[model samples]
Target: MQLQPWIIMATISAFLIQICLTVESPPSADKIDLGVHPLELEHFVNMAHSNQVERSCGKYVIPRVTSRVGFSYSANTSFYAFVNDDMTARDNLKFLQRWFLKFPEYKNRDLFLTGESYAGHYVPQLAQLIVQSKVKFNLKGVAIGNPLLEFNTDFNSRAEYMWSHGLISDITYEAFTVICNYSQVRREIVMGSLSPACSGVISQVSRELGKHIDSYDVTLDVCLPSVVSQSERLNQPRGTEKIDVCVEDETIKYLNRKDVQKALHAHLKGVSRWSICSEVLKYEYRNLEIPTIHVVGAVLKSGIRVLVYSGDQDSVVPLTGTRTLVNGLAKDLGLNTTVPYRNWFQGRQVGGWTQVYGDKLSFATIRGASHEAPFSQPERSLVLFNTFLQGKPLPEATVVL
Candidate 1:
């Protein structure tokens, strides 16, 4: 089987941007509605095509950021409404097999699997299937950003992260740790019942955190109009420098446009609007508990490199828990530390800290970034992406005299 010479980037819970094949200059900032936040996507692509990237990796590969047909705007919930991680993984495997058969010209070219957030599960599960299947893909590596690897560790860490960041009161933090951790709360919610104690704790925490903050990025401000109308119309600045907090709303509007939908061959099946998340598809919430960290271990054992990265500022799937999980996974796999934990540089500033285990498994954090690190810190994320694809360690901190 011949796979496309493509770097597949998936966003788990965001509006899909149909495949962008060219490397043209990015559009102006004023034009924010390109379905998937053009600034971030274009910025990453432009960086990938830079002369520096060419010098580092010998050549630049045009990346193709796509989502599954049954997801986002392409979903036909009228027929098949229920979906889960396993189903998503199987669907992705089938998609890739068909893609390989259709694009035989991309034979022997390198392919890297990358995603963020819940893709923590989707990417690994699909990779595991690919590795175990009969198909032969030149699978280079897998990278997940602010991924959910383990349920308890990832969700339970939110309390500490919020407390440390001063997003919640001390009393609420204590309640979160003792009376009800996030994992327990999540379980109850999934089961469609929340205990009185957990419900009270949640209310108190919500009151303390207020309505202005974004839990995904504790440091970033929420879009006011988005909160009110559920649309992206505000011109306010966010806590993060240069990131548009209203991009999600813009994407929702763009994807729902009749022209945009027609152009992409997408239609709203048994639905009136296109949402960032599926409104009709009932996802199996229990699947969130099935940890994918072990699947990551299996991928590593299959000779496929794994890169687990986090955005340090993210309370949801914060760097602390991810680091612990990666360290534990390394110890369990008996992989020795090949690269000691150290700061990496993006130009003159520190990009983040990274550590490699036995050359196959690695962990890193994007400093001053959010759960969606690439959306918030595109340049640094690009640097990390390039380094990972080239099978090179992140650049060491540069010295200045």
Candidate 2:
């Protein structure tokens, strides 16, 4: 299986973490070759710089070509008219099988599947497939940040997270949980109809939270083009450290440029502009109801290391629910807590809390981080990533001399 001419591969070094995009595939295609666009390229570059992987790890490689299916710039819109988890997983398996055959160098190196948010589903499903298929890839582990493991647990936790973080009032919180929880709201939205009561509750919650607050990272400020234009703000120091709230806007602008697209060998097939997410893929909303925690457990049983980390500030997938689910999974497996719940360290500062179950399964949180932890708390997120890759526990408390 020779590498396709269209397949763009960027070799970093020993480490290979493929970012899994959760978009569905076209009905006609058994396997969709997901390309590395400029936006993702920028993301990984920032991640590498932030993590200082090259500075510390000598040589680090990020293979631009990921098996996880996504809408390619040149892909026909009508081909990927529908997508779901099961289909996406099958497509990913095929891609990985082909990828390994093409790049035999990565066959012996450590391969970790990593992604955030919906990747909770994609990563686990793909890993399970790999295990079941008995593929001989050196798959050491998997890590997902702010992942959606269980729909109800993940979604329902949002209300309490909002209230606890002071993003919503007590009254609003009560209504949000009782009247119309996030799960219900999501269900309604997926069904293409919102009940009046749910609608009112959602409206109140939204109004109370306000548009200025980013739900992804409640602590971070929202991007306001008028108040802080991208050009001006880029030169100024970010109040939230290195994170640019307007990076999405900047990425959209950069990727949409004719010169940039030509350089990356990417072009819009049917869409006018390159958006963060796919606009044409009609994904199966019902797939969200399918819990991947059990799939995660299956992977764990196969002796593969699993690290589920959450950014504490992420309201979208609250740490509380994730922690609870991990704890329950550990209990069900009867894995004693090898490491008790304690704060891990990054230099002198407290990074976040972590707990390990049976040494194989672990869960940790990145303090002051968003849904995309690395984008905000880069240094801390880097520490987590580095430690996980080393198969070591997160850094313990730093002792002052």
Candidate 3:
């Protein structure tokens, strides 16, 4: 007896479903198609417990578009939104391996890892790890935006930025001097009372200094002022749209889960510290030799790009920092050749610049934007990524915006 087409299709579908069920899913709740242009993006979330989705890079799968590739890592494990830890890095590599196995067509794809802020550290560390695994893996380039690569430079840049941005005042600067001179205990106590007026004075002094400063623990001081203002701003409801891009509610839940934190805590033992800059600077600074890659765009690549983006209005790692980091990476990779600087934004002097390193390295910057330009201006970011994907130099500013 011959079966009907519908019946045959149903039987085949059921059999396939059973086979898939037996094969073990990709350790993800479900894969979602973001429907972005140029690339048909697929996303995955770790919903092991709660119904809410927790974005996990290692869990997401997308067909390799070209030999060129892009990777994103969560910024910091301390915060669920930015799960930047050794475990996450291992998982990312594992996922890439799985992705390669699942799609052999991308065997020759050149990989470019990118991220921002906390990713400054995450991107480079992962790149180093992936390169080490190059005997078994293939990678090409990396980009980091406002990365925190060098402990000294990173902290100093933050201090200089805060001062220049008018976020710190002379009083705050004095407090900073005192803190750096005294014990951490005394510094913390003094910093607790510095007001906005003090912060503004610090900013003016920082500008006058005209160079980056790093001799103090200014992360809290720099960010406290902004955080306070942001909290106030967030107090007002923004209609129905979400204003901030973070997994705050889900993050809290994950943090509260002892098992989850334990899993993360184990991996974060030595690599991550509450204030890595301060701790390392005091003791373990010399132990760091991890192969690192920093991915930066012309603008910010916050959670949207798999990292946290910290911007300083007054910064060396400002637009300059991103440009310098990418350029340095390009040069280090032998990709830095005499490529022309192109203006990509309208009325912007230098929206972007390009240099081709050896054969597989490249670098460029975004136009008219500050540290977090990627978040502020995404279109340009897309343009930069697209160019990098094509293995071509970034275009010079044409329309002059």
* Model 2 Cα lDDT, one tens digit per residue, 1-401: 11112332334543543322222122222111121111232331231122263332322222222221222522344445666788667766776677668677666766677767777887899899989988887777888888899989999999999998888999999999999999999999989999999999999999999888988899888887874565466556535335667766655666567775676565455667665556555677788888999999999999899999999999999999999999999998999999999999999889999999997899999999988786777678778877887789888867875
Evaluated against the true structure, the overall lDDT of model 3 is 0.37
How many residue pairs clash per model? 0, 6, 52
lDDT of 3 by residue, 234-310 (tens): 46564442222322233333433557446433222323312102121121112222224443231122111222222
What lDDT score goes with residue 117 in model 1? Answer: 74
Q: Clashing pairs in model 1?
A: none
Looking at candidate 2, the ten consecutive residues that score lowest on lDDT are 29-38
Model 3, total clashes: 52
Q: What is the C-alpha RMSD of each candidate to the true structure, in Å?
A: 7.4, 5.1, 14.0
**Model 2 steric clash pairs:** 12-60, 12-61, 13-60, 13-61, 26-79, 26-80
lDDT tens digits by residue: candidate 1, 232-348: 333234432476676665666665667756755554445576555444556667888999999999999999989999989998788989999999999999999999999999988
Q: Which stretches of candidate 3 lie over 4 Å from their true place?
A: 1-88, 135-138, 174-337, 340-343, 346-363, 367-373, 399-401
